[model samples]
Target: MEHDVPSLPEEIIVKILLRLPTKSLLKFRCVSKSWLFLISSYDFAKAHLKNSNDDRLMFGSKGFSMDLYTWSPQSAADHSAFGGTIYPPLDQNLLVQRVCIDCPLYEPHDVVWFEGSCNGLICLSSSDESLSLWNPTIGKAKKLPNSGTVLDFDYYGIGYGFGYDELIDDYKMVESLSFEPFAGAPTLDIQLKVYSLRANSWKTLLNWPGGHAFGGSGKFLNGAIYWSVHRLDGPIEWVIVSHDLSTYTFSVVHLPHLHNEDNDDVNVDVKVLRGCLEICCERNTHMDIW
Candidate 1:
C-alpha cells in the first residue's frame, strides 16, 4: 500500500514557501497549476521578498555581455565546515553564483546597464536607451516601449531610477535625460518622465536641474531612489537628488557638514544601512559616515 503525504493548508504552505530562495521557488512553480498561479502572483512575490532570508549581492557589467554574478549570504552563513570562511563572516566573502540571461537589444552596439533592483525585479537599460524589467528568479522579462522623448539618441544623455510605490501598488521607472543646448538656448535642459507598470504608459514629469547623475546605480530607500549628483552651475558642490515614488516629485537632501571645506573633492557615495540612508565620504586617510 502507498502512504500519502499529508495535505498542507494554504496558509501553512505560503509561510513555508515565503522562506525559500528564488532559485528554489522557480522550480517549485512547476509542481502544479495551483502552485504556478500562487508563485507567480504579485502578493506572493512581495511577501516572499519581505520574508526571504537569502540576501544576495548582485554584480553585472555592460562589458560582460549577458553575464551576472550573485553572492548569497545565507548559504555562506549556513556552511560551517569551511574553516577558511571564518575571517569576516561567510556573508562578506564573494561566494558568487554566476548567471546568464538573454536580453533583446535595441542596437547591435548597445551595452547592458543594470539600472536598479526593487524587491526581486531588476531594471535593465541598454546603450541604445531601451528599458526592460526582469525577474531572475522566475526567468521572466518584459521590455518597455520607448517613452518617445528622444527618437534617434539625439539627447545629450539618459539616466534612470527605479523603485516601487506602495500607495498605489505599482512599480515606476524614472527616466532623466540631459539635453545638449540648442543653438539659441542659454543653458542645458533636463527632462523627466515616469513609466508606470500599472498604467503601462509614460507620463512626462517636471524638468529637473541639468547635471550628470552619479553613475553605476542609484540606491532605493523608503519609496524613493536617491542619487549623488554634481550640479552643473554655481559653485562646485555635491547634492543628494531624490525622486519620491508616491508623489512623483523630486527633492534634494543635504549632506553632512565636512570639517575640511578645502577638500571638496572627497569621494562620496550613498548606501542603505540599518534601515536608513548613510552618506559615506572618503578622505585621503580615512572615511566618515553620516
Candidate 2:
C-alpha cells in the first residue's frame, strides 16, 4: 500500500508557527535546525510577541518575586486572581531587546520595579531618586534625566507613549516629567519632556499649571498617554498628556472626578493593568481599575 504525504509551503508553516505562544514555539525548535533558526529570528520573535495580545497582567513583590495573574471580569468577587499555578520566569530575551533599543533607562536599581505599565512598557524608578521607562515584552528601556539640581525631591512622575507627526513617518516617545521640590517649596515645578527615539535625547516642553505626576505606568491610548495627577486642593485628577509621535508636541486633557477623602489615602500609584492604565490606592489591597 502506498501513502500520500501532505505538502505545505514553508512560508505558510512559518506563519502558523508564529501564531503559537512562545512556550509552544520554543518546544518546536527540536523539529529541525532550520525550524530553530526561524523561531529565533528577530523578525519572527517580534511578530509573534506583537500579535500575542494576551492582555494579562503579572504582579510581583519583593519577597515573592513575580507571579503571573489574570484579571477575570466574570469573577466580580475577585478581579485580580492567579490565572495559573505555574509562573514563568522573567524573559531575559525580552530584557536584552529593551537594553538594545533603549526602551527604558536601566541604572543600578534606578529602574526599580514599579506597578505601572504602558503599551507593553513598565514604568520604573531609581530607588526613590530617579525615573526610567521599560518595554517588558521587547526589553527596551530609556532612562529620564534628573529634573532639578537637588536630588532630595519627594515625588516624581514619568510617562511614555508613541505618536505620529504629519512631517515624519516614525513614532516618538512622549515623556512627561512632574515633581515637587521638597516640602518647604511654595510652588511645584511641573515640566513635560519629550524623548525622541530617533534623536536619542530629551527636549523640554511647556510647563503646566498645578502639580501633576504621571499616574502609575502611563497608558498609551489613541496616540495619547494617560496619567493621574493630584491637585493642590486635595483632589486626585486624571490628565491625558498627549505626544505627537511624528511632530513630537505635548498637550494635556482633563479627566473625570478622582479624589481621596483621607489625606494619607492617595491612589497616585498607577500602572498598566491588563493592557489598560490603572491605579491602585491601597498597596496591600491592590485595587486597580482601568
TM-score of each candidate structure, all chains considered together: 0.76, 0.55
- In terms of lDDT, model 2 sits at 0.53
Ten-residue segment with the worst summed lDDT in candidate 1?
81-90
lDDT of 2 at 169: 33
Please provide, for model 2 over 1-290, each residue's C-alpha lDDT reduced to its tens digit, 9 standing for 90 to 100: 99988968999998899788776876888889999899889678768866875654434344422222333333423442334322324352221111222333543423354544433555555455555666554455666565433434687554444433325433345555556767765545666666554565667666444445444445555455555566654545556554445444557666555443443444555444434645555423444454
TM-score, cand. 2: 0.55
Q: Which 10-residue window in model 2 sums to the lowest lDDT?
A: 92-101
Which regions of candidate 2 deviate over 4 angstroms?
A: 1-7, 26-37, 40-42, 60-111, 115-124, 128-176, 180-183, 196-199, 207-217, 230-240, 244-246, 255-290
Instruction: Give me the overall lDDT of model 1.
Output: 0.72
User: For each candidate, what is the lDDT?
Assistant: 0.72, 0.53
